[model samples]
Target chain A: MAPAEIRNALASHPFLEGLPEKYLDLLSKLAFEVSFGQDEIIFREGDPSSLFYLILSGKVALEIASPGRHVIIQTLEAGDELGWSSLLENTSKQFRARCLEPVRALAFDGARVVALCEQDHEFGYHIMRRALGLVAERLRATRIQVLDVYSPKGVRAQ
Target chain B: MSTASHAAAPPARPVMEPVPVQIRSVVKETHDTFTLTVAPPPGDPVSAFEPGQFSMLYVFGVGELPISISGDPAVRESLTYTVRSVGQVTYQLVTRRPGDYIGIRGPFGTSWPLKEARGKSVLIVAGGIGLAPLRPAIYSILRHRGDYNRLVILYGSRSPRDLLYRKEFAAWGLLPDTQALCTVDYGGVSWRGYVGVVTTLFRHVRMQPQETVAMICGPEIMMRYAARELEARGLPPAQIYLSMERNMKCGAGFCGHCQLGPYFVCKHGPVFAYPEIKPYLDLYEL
Candidate 1:
């Protein structure tokens, strides 16, 4: 994608909806377009979290492998972000992300973004705030999933 | 509480009498749920019902249970109910064979506000079998498609296998102005749909909050969360509705069994505006 097009995409994403133009311009410099085919593993659990991605289209499933089964924890779609842990330091992916369909995303190198954050405190603050919101939203969704709210026992108990 | 009246009141209607209807067919919707279609005796066509109304179904020699009428309101030849076999009465109700007779006491209770919702977008959030009651409203809206603005359905269940109306979800999503999305709490490797609670789908939906009427049903807990999310998204409390469930005995309000606060769920509602029931919803075991 062209540099101008990349900036526009970053500006349009929900995560950076109100982000200042300078930050988008700076982030765009560090962003590159990436694609994955169906069933392709974008990253596996325990892998180094090197890149953060903003999904442009299609679905990706976050999953875990147990003794004899692979369970999907959640599915993220267009306009959703993945590899949030990459925005932090000394952390690795907590789950595997597999493309459910052909996927197009904007990928950013974590180390460069971290360097940019340290060089610009305001940018760091804005990016981390949005990341925190994303984490909170996922935490809330996981809690509801843990409740097993749709089961007969769960329904009656409520 | 004095029983001294100048004249004795006339006897009330026999609301307890159950009208025997023959089961026309029983379709298994999931491992634990069955949709039963019943037809009334000859010349006594089944009564018409508004969407969201429920009936007290009696399985002879077993017991009776309250079930929402899940079929299209436009088709009055028969009434359909989706029963989840979680107990003895429900087990008997779902196990009955075609041509077997069961008693139905009503097309009772209040219904979805489809009339008031005309010209407005309809947002339906249902979890598990809660979708059964909301299905009628969907049919009614689609039957008169031009009368409504948009139809948005967000449904969630325990797993992909537990989803109701799976084929219809695809059909509805194809409609010009309808958006239907389903999610599950858990999904296996083969399941490709969204995996999250019903509330999580709200972010994907676009609606004019002021011009939309929200209807939700599920476990009360789910409804509570869904309603809260809708309100957070700018929907007015008055425009949001929820279908409440309770221990209903008499189809009429005569029995105190279905009371919730100052209202009798059977007579006053099975469907209530959010603000009207908000206070009582959080009260434990009320």
Candidate 2:
């Protein structure tokens, strides 16, 4: 997709709303569309941070590899963003991202965005705020997951 | 407490009267859960019930426990209950044979909002064996498919092995306008499905928030979280209903074992709109 089209797509997502015009334009220019077939890996745990993605369609499962099993830690669907580690310094991908279906996303070159953020604190703060919001939400979800809050207690499997 | 007044009292609803039933069949649903089909004794009338109503099952030598009717309500010959052997009564109930007699007193409690849900989208969220009580409601909806628009079922279990009606979910998903999504708290190497709480499914479902009605049944904490999540997704509290679980001794209102503040869950409800019970939900000891 063209840069202008990419910008339009990003604008449709609520998190990308209210950004400075210059940063929006820069992100648009830097963003490119990416897609993966079912079961395809978008990124692997410990992989070098390269790009972050804003999901346009379908779902991505964030998982961890164990001794003999792949445990899905979370599932992200349309309008969800992933690979925030890419924009944070010295951090590698923490989880494996695999396509749960045919997924289309707007992929942004993370290093370039980080460079731009360093040059512009105001723009960087706005980006950080949004990233923090996503992080908090994920943390809350993880807490709920860890609790196994849905499991029945007293009578056993009610 | 006057003898004359006690004798003059009107007869209880037939649903509260214990009737004899014979275990017709028992299917082990998972490692610990068993689905028991009980047939009423010959010449006995097995009351037909709406979805979400429960019955008090009496294991003759053990005790009586309240269990939701898990079979299709339209089928009048027998009632089904999916029970997990968690206690003395439940263990004995599930271990009974095809010819053994057990007492059944109910078809009690309020039912799922089947009529109110017509012509609108319906969302059913169930956790663990909580799915059994909601099963009849799903049967009712699917039987009258034209009455509703979108039908979505979001279910969460401890594991793939713990999912109830595993074979039936696929068939339900095949029906027009119906969607079934299952998630497990944990999955093994062979399991390949979403892994998360039932609330996580809110984002994946497509519905006209204003025009949809949601019915949820699960552990108390799960319902609390799910109701909040649904409200956050724009579904009004009034449009979201819940089926509650409490220690129910008498299937009628006479026993206070199942009381929830002002409501007797056995009589006034097993199903209540979220707004009606929101205040009591989080109260300590409620």
Candidate 3:
């Protein structure tokens, strides 16, 4: 993708809404324009995570395996963020991320974003707030699954 | 979610019975444990409560739990409790600072029967941290010295250090009508108090079986046995009130986690008159 297109995409994300144009342009320059083949496994369960990516094209499937079932927890499309564990700590990918079709995403080393955020309090605040919201959403969704509201014995739904 | 554009308390309508409380101070009462003082929020009034009742405390990010009030009834502005950090949510609780908000949904459930114990002997039994819910009842009894008859409290702890409200037991015992008996499962070199289960303290308590009402709270195993001992001594099942703790997710009756038979502990109890719950609670896994 061209530099102008990269800048446009960054500006459109709700997380980067108030980021200055210069920083957005700089972020686009630093991002690696990465691509994947159709049906590619971007990362497997338990793999050490060090990079964060925002999809530029195509789709990615996030799934977790338990016993005989593989639950499709979520699907990520173009402009969606993935690989958040890299931002949290030295954590591994919690779920497997697979390419549904040929996909393109801008990937960045997690350390680079951490360093940038450390230097920019405004940017850091927005990113941390977004990260916490993301975590809360995941917690709520998993709780919904565990409670199994729709199951007959799980909850009466009253 | 910062407070600037936050939603109001989940109940929508204001909580009127028990005051909306805030954390005024957080004290570490034991290893990896804490005691919080919840004072009335700003202009809210203090809530009236009985000895055995409870309040639902909600912490953001973390979840909610049903905690019994454990402070003096006279000090209505701030309520205090010693809570062990046993789970993830409680771990978050100990870390909260003064002025941090906490949601209080109750003063729910039936309280210790001060009226019934007026003319007869009253035996208060507690095991482990189960004392948290029973302390307010103990304090209320002590506060109203002549309103009741003989006062005897038998409290059991895992060790010397775990006995809650260490400062108050002595002062309470000084009251003309009160007698506080504290025992532990195991005693250290410095431990001079009674050693053995709290039930052993019952052997020392002599009362007309039909004349006394015992409010008991503790581990399920201990409560069951305590009831057995009381029944052997001739106190009817109808006279023993046990504070039962189930995992309460939502304080409302909606959550099923606290279901024991058909009762929701969060709403219906966490406390019940003995006869009302004994039949179902005796059934397996109830």
Candidate 4:
């Protein structure tokens, strides 16, 4: 996917499904396309929270690693977003991402997007609101996994 | 061996409602915590609830916490929650009185192993204030004591005085085929009961690992270590279920404060089968 093709795909994504076609055209100028080979590492967990990517082709796995091990937390395929780190004010990602298969993605420059947001506050508002919603959903999922209430003490709850 | 007995067990219940509600009673159980009894605002009875489901209690100036439903589902007019004062929102809830206004959001998330545990023994292990989340299961099992086999509750706290519902535990034990056991990390001169760690208390009961459904809630270390012990005792991962907790804000699954891998404790579960969560158990602050 080229820059224009990547942006077109992103505009068609479920997240941006309801936006007007003109907005999609405006987005085309903001995206860049990149590709990765199978089993390639997309990003490490602690990498800088720089950019956001949308999948063009292939699959990516978001994984969490501890001592000598890693667990696949989520998988990304066509149209799914990667590098959601651009949303959080946090400096690094909480999970590492790897290409599960040969993949192509549309990348957006985080700084440039932030700049766009600063200039065009309306567009920035939509981006921030959508990004924040994603963050909220992910946070809820992480909480469930971390709080293991299913011990032998699986006693009743309030 | 007892498949015949399982067929006789009652069906499991679900917890979800769409009615508005208000606080009916707030009994100060501990110094900074209370057992909030919320009834349907004014008219209709509350929707049904299962053990392990939670509702978001919202205060005007403060926020909300996903407090588990602590009482029986048979009586659905009101729900109970034992909340401790840990943050600003909880402190507000703890300080409120009987008639004070508050918001109730859900009875969200999955229920415990009801039919799965039928005709099999139940071993409930809880630690600290974690015991609050497990209280409803205790009451539910005992409510239909004859439908199941043995019921054993193993609860632990920091100290003997820190135990919740002491008299109730004693009373639960007196019921046929039921027992209440407790322990602490350390003991004072007045402490005459088990003292070491909650995991050590697993030694006292005869847990038929295969047939028993182990429901546990406690700190991460306690659940991790306890699960190890139970597995060593012949309980496979499938036979175990764990309730997960995260910084839950919107019980309806909107907030990012609580996320564990791909599941939302506020939505998919606060209760998950051990095998389903075993992979991410060790992930830090995931």
Candidate 5:
């Protein structure tokens, strides 16, 4: 996708929508389209969180290793944003991301994006606020998942 | 298979009496949930139900449990209920053989937005056994496909093993303009599907929020989150509907057992516009 098309797409995403044009321009400079074939691992737990992703299409499974195998904790899809660990200082990957199908995403360099956030306090504040919202939402979702609200063992029928 | 187009009103006969019905079949849906197909006595008229209405199944001397109708509303030959063997009453009901007789009291409560949903895109979000209540609505929409635009189903279960209607979900996705996405809260080694809460599947849904009507059936917490997300994405609260649960006893309004605020969930609803019930959804121990 062309940079203009990518910018347009980002403009409509729930997370990025309403962001100023200047910030989108900055993001566009660093943004590039990346794709992964089905079953390919995008990032592994404990690996450096090198890039932030804005999923443009397809699904990405966020998984955690349990006793014997990896358990998918969450699935990210088009219009969803992930890899916020990229913006946090010294934070490595917390979950392994794998392509559930042919996946395409808008990838941003973590280091450069973090540097821009630090250099521009105003932009930094806006970005951090948005990321905070994402984090809060994810935290709520993760908390709900831990509750296992649907598990027969968790909630009994009334 | 079409029942009366609208069953939103109470039946003319006394609604509280338990009618004997024989179990026709019982199909295991998952490890814990099973679909029981029951037929009324050979000559007795089977009660027809709307999408979100529920039935009170009586297991002889054990007790009675409120279960949602999961089969096609159009099919009046038999009533199907997908029940999780979670409590004492359900356990007793599920153990009965095909020829066994059980008492049924209702096709009670309100239903999904069948009339208003016509010509609009429909989104059905179901979690676990919550899917059972919404299955009838899916059947209604597909049965009259031309009346609606797009049909989107977002279903999430605890795992692949817990997903209900696995084959039917695949078949629904093949229909024109219909999208069915399934996710699990957690996946095992052999599971290769999306892993997330039902809300995560919202990003994959294609709809004009203003033109789509959403029906949600899940845990109360899940419905709250899903409804909030839908509203955030521009759907009006009135356009989003949900099925609510309470400790229902009598299938009529006379019993206050299933009361929510001033409303009787048994009589006024199982299906309610999100805005109508949002205020009481968080009350303590109600």
Candidate 6:
């Protein structure tokens, strides 16, 4: 996509809804559009975190491989972000992200984005705050899932 | 002397008697849950019920259990119940065939606030079998579509296979001003819908908290979390309702078995405003 179009997309995204015009322009310069087919593994666990993603459309599953099974930890869809770990330096992915449907997303090089953040503290603060919100939301969801609230035993206990 | 003695005896309370109704049909909803339609004898129609009311079902040689009415309230010819075969009584109730007779008592308890919600959007949050109780309210709102604004249904189940009324959910989503979304706690490779707890889906839908009335069901923990999230989104406690379940023996307040705080769940409610029961909900071993 062209730089102007990328900037427009970033501006419209919920995560960056109120991002300043200059930052949108800066982030757009670092982002490139990417797409993947269904069932493709975008990144595997322990893979070097290279790119951060903001999903434009379709679904992806965050999963973990267990003995004889693959457990889906959560499913992210349009308007959701993936690969927050990429924002940190020298980190590896904790979960495998696989496309559950054909997906389109905006990809940003982690090192370049990190450099931009350091250069512009205000921009870095905005980005880090949103990422922290996403992490807290995911942690809350994970706790609810662990409760097994729908089990028959859980119902009876209530 | 015999005539005087007979005249002095008090009459038995008709409300306590179980009326025999024949099972019309049974549809297996999932591996463990079944929906049964029961009808009163010919020339006698079953009493109408508001959404969220429950009936005490008695299976001969087994036992009686309280189940929410899952059918449309407008259709008074028969009453429907969705039963999960988790115990001996529920198992026997689900296994009964057509032409079999089972006893049905009062279609008792409080109902969803459909009357108050007529001019505003209705938000339904159901988990697992909790959907069964809320299904009737959905039907009522759809039947009188102009009476309400937006209709949003957020449903969550244990997995893709455990979802109820799968086809109906698609149909509901197709209606104008209605949105239906389903999520599961777990998903297999082929499942493409939202995979998360019910609360996670709250952010995806837009609501005018002041103009919305929310009804929630499922396990107590799920309802507690759902209510908390709705409150965080600016909905008041009075506008939120939850269906509470307990070991109910008598369908009337005479039996103290179903007591929750100051109320009897069987008589006073299976549906209660959040604040009315909020304190009891968090009380340990209450």
Interface RMSD of each candidate, angstroms, one decimal: 2.7, 2.7, 20.6, 15.6, 1.9, 2.4
Ten-residue segment with the worst summed lDDT in candidate 1 chain B?
Answer: B1-10
lDDT string, candidate 4, A12-81, tens digits: 7766676566666667787877889987887888888887887877867677775666755555577567
Candidate 1 residue lDDT tens string, A1-158:
99999998999999899999889989998999999999999999999999999999999999999889889989998899999999999999999999999999999998888888899999999999999999999998898889887887775311
Q: DockQ of each candidate's interface versus the true one?
A: 0.54, 0.46, 0.01, 0.02, 0.58, 0.46
Chain A TM per candidate, in order of listing = 0.97, 0.92, 0.84, 0.83, 0.94, 0.95
- Tens digits of per-residue lDDT for model 3 on B211-274? 8878888876667768878988898777787877777666666758878887877666766777
TM, every model: 0.93, 0.89, 0.58, 0.60, 0.90, 0.90
| Tens-digit lDDT string for candidate 6 (B114-152) | 887889999999999999999999999999999999999
User: Each candidate's fnat, in order?
Assistant: 0.65, 0.40, 0.00, 0.05, 0.63, 0.48
> Candidate 1 on B157-237: residue-level lDDT in tens?
999989988898889999998999999988899989999888989988888999999989999889998998999999988
Per-residue alpha-carbon lDDT of candidate 4 for residues B1-88, written as tens digits (9 for 90 to 100): 2111111111122222234456789887655457888776433333466787777777776665678777777777778888876667
The 0-to-1 C-alpha lDDT of every candidate, in the order given, reads: 0.87, 0.83, 0.69, 0.70, 0.85, 0.86
Docking verdict class for candidate 5: medium
Better of 2 and 4 by TM-score: 2
Per-residue C-alpha lDDT of model 3 across residues A28-100, encoded as one tens digit per residue: 8778778998768899899998888888788676767877765454556665678988886678999887776
**CAPRI quality of model 1:** medium
Interface RMSD in angstroms for candidate 2: 2.7
lDDT of 5: 0.85
Error of 6 at B89 (Å): 1.3
What are the per-residue Cα lDDT tens digits for candidate 2 across B1-286? 0001001112244656678888899999998899999887543444567788887888876888889999998888888999988778888988999989999876677888888888999999998888999999999998898999999999988778889899898788887788999988766544668777888788779999999999999888789889999999899788899988887888678879889999888877778888888999998576
Instruction: Write the residue-wise lDDT of candidate 5 on B175-214 in tens digits.
Output: 8999999988888746767887899888778899989999
Clashing pairs in 1: none
What TM-score should be assigned to candidate 6? 0.90
Model 6 clash tally, residue pairs:
0
